[model samples]
Target: MAFRPLGRRAYGSIPHLPGSRTGPADRHLSPALARTLTQRARDARDHVVVLEKLDGSCVAAARVGDSLLALGREGQLAAHSANEARRLWATWVARHAERFLAVLRPGERVVGEWLALAHGTRYALPHEPFVAFDLMRDEARSPWREVTERLGNAGFVLPGLVHEGAPLAVEAVMERLGGAGFHGALDPVEGAVWRLERRDAQGVRVELLAKYVRPDKVDGSLLPENSGRPAHWNWRPEAPPPPPEMS
Candidate 1:
């Protein structure tokens, strides 16, 4: 069965910029607009919240009508009990999740990483599973503080909060991360997502976000430089010439 749709795009994605992309598959856009977006991000580097990009399968627990269903990216099922996370949420966190369900307004959902045995063990976890660095309230994201507080109240493991209150170079932030993973080990963290909160003097609000895929780990699975389109097909930036200026 289907559940609520996810966020339109990740932070710093080409569409996050001022202009726009034709579609997810092609993702064609003007180079000048792309550069402008990057420039704006650079200018707003003073205030940002960075969270460790957990390297695991994406999983979610959404309120599907009367049932709370666990899902993978693209609404894929977790292979019955075969999926470690399915069990983790369907059974382990099942009871605790009720507290969350009590408040959820039906269409809302929570998404997080499902660190199971499938992806190499960086945490050396003893038992069941883990879900952190989540997306709560359907497509809407809860701030770092609210996420932590809510998860803590529900007995879920807290995700890492590497940097806060500044916009810094991806390299600098990666250096600080230095092979850190969920349990604080000197291993690959994949990279980090910068969640910038911007507020104007007139009380207007905006947010600039981006995902910086680690240079060392440029798997198409998660790339800051690349992304999939509407058809969920991944695409790479090639050496083709640009379309004539948008006049």
Candidate 2:
């Protein structure tokens, strides 16, 4: 499919930054969040959710005044004038800036994971731009439902959301992963991250409670086997995982 950016603009009016703000250079990076899980692999009582893990690299879009910044997963400034990935990211931002700006107020920022065509089967995916998962925000409310609804109306594909019960266990998470056949799947994704939504002094926040992955389920043939790469590398899951004993 030909990739089209969303119709939203960046920030229309610059709003005051929340709390004591610092320059972008001094801003602290968001930490990796995980989810909590319970024990019992086959038990449906465990709280867990599943979504298709898109095969692509990470991209983040932030608006400061009239300027819009696109950053790669490594926190480097994305330069479309030089790299293919940055060029694609720039196209995506241009197309979706309007809607993105609408969802995010001025001064406030929304951090999401961008999945594009770079490696594996997704490389052939036309256009190569879309938001896979929402990570964090500085807004007053959880804009997930609103942002997703807007994206849907604008004909943009937002990442899927599944709401499982509360108090999830490890066995239950593994059961869902096994049933999902995560490893056998053709997509080159690691697994899902667990999250919890709550309200605090900072408004509504979705916390990255944990990350989960079943190594046995991954398709080893697709990856560089015996290439002396870091064997302990784990896929960043959208939802966090339960403890090891739970699995």
Candidate 3:
């Protein structure tokens, strides 16, 4: 049987996030998730985690049966994508197939940012190109603590940890992230992501993710297609040095 990777859902923007372009379906948080956020605001130690929001294409490596497949955000097999970045992601996955297969169970997928191609925030990466943020098996995500340990143990780089307590105002989160994030983003840090988990009525855990993007952020400001220049890669193995400038 062929593998069927699940598509990652678009994360909703926190209500206070400025200049968010979220559609109607993604603008509102579920009542339970909202309560979690509210509780976090009252207590500094509510179950909330904040991480540096990376600006890169969302991709995943899924171990299906005996094969590992590279997938785009929509769960399409990336090897067949027309986009060069997605194709490159497939090659990266193949190169690291052994690690992915070793760490993933039959139906699990490691979803993360593929930073090989610059998007809004380009990086001078301090680690491998792919920064795994979540371990999912369909719609459910592993809890934050487990996610950190699992992905870290599996030798995957993770997004910079920003905060883990009360929800901070956007300005505060940016201040903590500073001009360049831990990954060495050349431009302004785009924003931060908030993740919270709570048990449902059936006692099944539900994970929620919300984001706060900078109000002035311009999507894809650095891509070749948008910038009309040669591509700037965040990670290119054996990348050649740039030519000397003419006087």
Lowest summed lDDT window (length 10), candidate 1 = 229-238
The best-first sequence of candidates by TM-score reads 3, 1, 2
Indicate which candidate wins on lDDT.
3
The candidate, 1 or 2, that scores higher on TM-score is 1
Tens digit of lDDT per residue, candidate 2, span 203-236? 5454323443434433233333433443222232
Winning candidate number (TM-score): 3
Best first by lDDT, ranked: 3, 1, 2
Flag regions of model 1 displaced more than 4 Å.
1-47, 64-66, 77-89, 93-96, 102-105, 118-121, 126-128, 200-208, 218-247
Given candidate 2, what's the lDDT at residue 95?
64
Listed in order, each prediction's TM-score against the native is 0.61, 0.53, 0.81
lDDT of each: 0.50, 0.43, 0.75
Q: What TM-score should be assigned to candidate 2?
A: 0.53
Error of 3 at 110 (Å): 0.7
Clashing residue pairs in candidate 1 are: 11-209, 11-210, 12-209, 12-210, 24-229, 24-230, 25-229, 45-167, 48-166, 179-187
lDDT of 3 by residue, 1-247 (tens): 3233554432212443444445455464554555565343434334677799899999888877998988887777787766777878888898889988888889888889899989888788888889898888866677777777777887889999988756555566789999898898999888888786554555424356777777688888888789998888888767333332445
